[model samples]
Target: MKFDCLIVDDEMELAETTCEYFNLFDVHTAFVTSAEACREFLREHEVSLLLLDINLGGTSGFQLCKELRLTTSIPILFISARSSEDDVLIALDIGGDDYIHKPYTLRVLLAKVKAVLKRWSNEPIPEEDGGLLQAGPVQIDTKLRRATLNGEPLKLKTMEYKLLHYLVQHKNRVIPKEELFSGVWGDIFAGDGTLNVHIRHLREKIEVSPKEPQLICTVWGIGYAFEGE
Candidate 1:
């Protein structure tokens, strides 16, 4: 069976409530109380998005996210009470699509989830010339939402792919932080820590050495520029 959304939370009451609320609005949602249950559920069903909590009793949601990344690119939104910037950064860095602080209103969360699904269903932005985008050793198939390095496939999550696609599309120009945030994430409120971590992950995938990246260069006081050979 295919589910539109799955809420993986140790807070059973909150998870159940969220699931019921989403289903009430025709969202087709489900809930699981632990990371193990989440894994088991995925094995048996198809899920479009995940509402994950940071702490899952004995199992860490971050670990589960990392593990899932090895196989699937399902969008994950972290919903937790941990409001620390460090926690948010870690969540985004480790493949989370978005992070929502706890004590959230059900309506707002449902709207956000619907918005994400809608965005996922939309067609990828195409190049002016049209066709595959090749720069340096990286090649992006916009239609497929996939990127390859040196002809090898890269396992990029949704946000990572969006960031890379935007950067590569506008290569050789220094893009300001605010512009990249708004352009790629569609939100100017996205934190620098979140952007920085995503950039590091991108560097690790495309650069010969993440310590000395040659493609995506930083402008120190400003932002980043993609200088492809």
Candidate 2:
């Protein structure tokens, strides 16, 4: 079975409530109360996105996310009461696409989920020209929505691909953080930490020395510029 979203939360009441809310909005949703249950559910079902809680009984969502990333590129949004910056950073660092704090309004959560679903959908973005964008050693096939570094395929998450494509499209120009948030994430509310983590991830993939990135250069307080010859 295919589900639009799955809530993997040990808080059964909250998970079921959120699931009901999503289903009310026509987002076919399901819930599992433990990390083991989530794993089992995934084995038998296809889920487009995950609303995962950090504290999942015996196993942490962070561990599950790390395990999932090893095989799947599906979007994972962390939903937790832990609001510390470190928690958020760790979530994004380990393959969680976005973090949502607890006590979140249902309407807002729904909007965020829909936006992610839209971005991660199979529908390709409208291509420019022949849709092949090159930046130094990196080449992006926009139509196929994949990128390669030195002719080798890059294992980029959905947001990483979008961010890289946006940077390459405007190569040599220093794009401000605000512009990146609006253009790539399509969310003005996206934090700087999220952008920073993704930028670092991209640099690690395309730059020979991530510490001193040549392809994606940081402009300090400004933004980033993709300088491709």
Candidate 3:
């Protein structure tokens, strides 16, 4: 069977409640209690997105995310009670699409999930000016939501694509962190760690050397600039 979303968390009560609430509003949601069950469920069903918790019956969600990323590109949103910047950074670094702090309101979670699903299921934005945007050896096809480095396809997640596209659109300018957050996430209150991690991931994909990135350069006390060709 196919589901729009799958909730994988050991907090059985919360997971079940969330699943029920989502289904009440036609989200077509399901819940599982452990990583083992999640794996088995995936084997038997098709899920468009995942709401995964960090701790799952002695198995880390980080490890599961790493394993799943090898086989899937579905969006993974980590839901946990841990709210430290390091936790958020680690979640994004480990292939998570977004990190939502626990003790969450159901309404907010539903809004976020719906927004992600809407984005996930849509085709790429059509370029208003048309054609590919080139930066050094990299190419971004806005119409296809595809990016390539040295003529080879780059596997970028949703946030990565949005960040890169925004940076390229404002190339040669040092965009403020606040501006980037507002522009990409539609939330000016987004944490710096979130932006920093996405920038690091973008560097890994588009730069010849992520350690010393020439394409996306840090502006010291300011923000980032895309020095494109």
Candidate 4:
């Protein structure tokens, strides 16, 4: 299977150049000039990662990152001319996995992309795959990527599935946010809120009550764990 990436930058020259670089590395990247183009491309195709710029046509890439995070859990790498510390924090805070300032080395950019993709690759859900990984009444299929509680399937998104899978695989252990981010989301460098959102969503689905999460438990400033009998 070909790993695909979408580059959303209004800088047509730089976008094409980067596209060429990715092609050289067999990353199979495609370029879009605007956020609308990105929306359209993603609707029809599966993307492994996103190379986004903060200034795209008149819209901020950070805004688009949050919007994308609402639906998909694709890895987001921010490449922009804005090198301010505040800008970097804001980008990572809003679901961006990597922050790259402009005038960057093409080799460095390529390396970062490769590193992120190697770390986090979401597998496709398979059929005839229900083998319940049960802890209490909550069950998750290790292969099929589905979770059930009280015999009802939980419609988990990509990120939620990953979080649940990792926690369940390491059941009874407290997983640090850094480890979770690296293992599940791919460690290009993502935001805390990204993990929080997915964790909140998973609790809502797997736990009987999101307010009092039973399945996905938090460990204060540490991270989260999946505990069951």
Considering every candidate listed, which one attains the maximal TM-score?
A: 2
Displacement of residue 222 (Cα, Å) in model 4 is 2.2
What candidate 4 gets wrong by more than 4 Å, as runs, is 1-3, 12-26, 35-48, 58-112, 119-130, 186-188
Q: Which candidate is the best by lDDT?
A: 2
Model 3 lDDT, full chain set: 0.88
Which whole-number lDDT from 0 to 100 does residue 145 have in model 1?
77
Lowest-sum lDDT 10-residue window in model 1: 122-131
Please provide, for model 3 over 23-65, each residue's C-alpha lDDT reduced to its tens digit, 9 standing for 90 to 100.
9999999999999999999999999999999999899999999
Worst 10 residues of 4 by lDDT: 121-130
Model 4 C-alpha lDDT per residue in residues 1-229, reported as the tens digit of each score: 3346889999999999999998998989999999988888888888999999999988889899999999987788888999877887787667776677887788878877886777665455333325556777777876666777778888865567767877876788899999997788665355565577678667777777899987788999999888886
**Which model, 1 or 2, shows the larger lDDT?**
2
Tens digits of per-residue lDDT for model 1, 1-229: 9999999999999899989999999999999999989999999999999999999998899999999989888778999999998898889877887888999999888887887776676676765446588778888987777889999999886778889998988888999999987788665545577788889999998899999999999999999999985
Ranking by TM-score: 2, 3, 1, 4
lDDT of 2 by residue, 1-229 (tens): 9999999999999999999999999999999999999999999999999999999888999999999999898989999999999999999999888888998999899988887787677466669859899979889998889899889999987788999999998999999999998788776656687898999888888889999888899999999999996
Of candidate 2, the 10-residue stretch with the lowest lDDT total is 117-126
lDDT score for residue 125 of model 3: 55
Q: Is candidate 2 or candidate 4 better by TM-score?
A: 2
Considering lDDT, where higher is better, how would the candidates rank from best to worst? 2, 3, 1, 4
Clashes of each: 0, 0, 0, 1
Q: What's the CA error at residue 163 for candidate 1, in Å?
A: 1.6
- After superposing candidate 1, which stretches have Cα over 4 Å from the reference? 125-158, 172-182, 186-192, 207-223, 227-229
